[model samples]
Target: GESVGLHLPTLSVQEGDNSIINCAYSNSASDYFIWYKQESGKGPQFIIDIRSNMDKRQGQRVTVLLNKTVKHLSLQIAATQPGDSAVYFCAETRGAGNMLTFGGGTRLMVKP
Candidate 1:
């Protein structure tokens, strides 16, 4: 099925180290990319986002890069923290008023 998925299901990083999470999408028309962080028994929280027109975008402690050529997306966390441990998902939308298709997600574990 055409969907979004992560190359790595789980990523472990030492506290204070930078972490990079990768995701791939099958849809070539997806225009908006979003990164989400989900904790146990909770809804996904928005981390950052990038548009298809742009290759990269940065937010507080985080950066999102979009590679339209490969249909790839990535999130980079500047400093891993225990509080950052969660399931990270990449989602995409084709246009305004469209539903988002989310990846299976990668679990990020920040080890002390």
Candidate 2:
């Protein structure tokens, strides 16, 4: 038998601190990965993304890192704020027109 996915239920961080959320995926064929943030009662909002060809990518105060060998992915947020508290999800897609497969989300609790 082989593993197919990974999940984290929650994460807590202090205001002004950095946060790192992790995810693991099974599909080796998946070529694109995306991170999304969802506040309570709202749809998921795109945060950042990285292609399998690259190991890491950066945006505003966020960074996405992918490790294909172990099928791991991580999202780092710098200087977390109370407004950053939300559920974060990682999604994968292999080809055009393919629907994204989303990993179990991690709830980020930011303490003020």
**Winning model by TM-score:** 1
- TM for every model, in the order presented, reads 0.96, 0.93
Task: List, residue by residue over 31-101, the lDDT tens digit for candidate 2.
Answer: 88899999999999999999999999999999999999999999999999999999999999867796788
Count clashing pairs, candidate 2.
Answer: 0
After superposition, candidate 1 runs with Cα above 4 Å error: none
Give the whole-model CA lDDT for all candidates, comma-separated.
0.93, 0.89
Per-residue accuracy of model 1 over 78-100 as CA lDDT, tens digit each: 98899999999999987678789
Instruction: Please report the candidate that would top lDDT against the real structure.
Output: 1
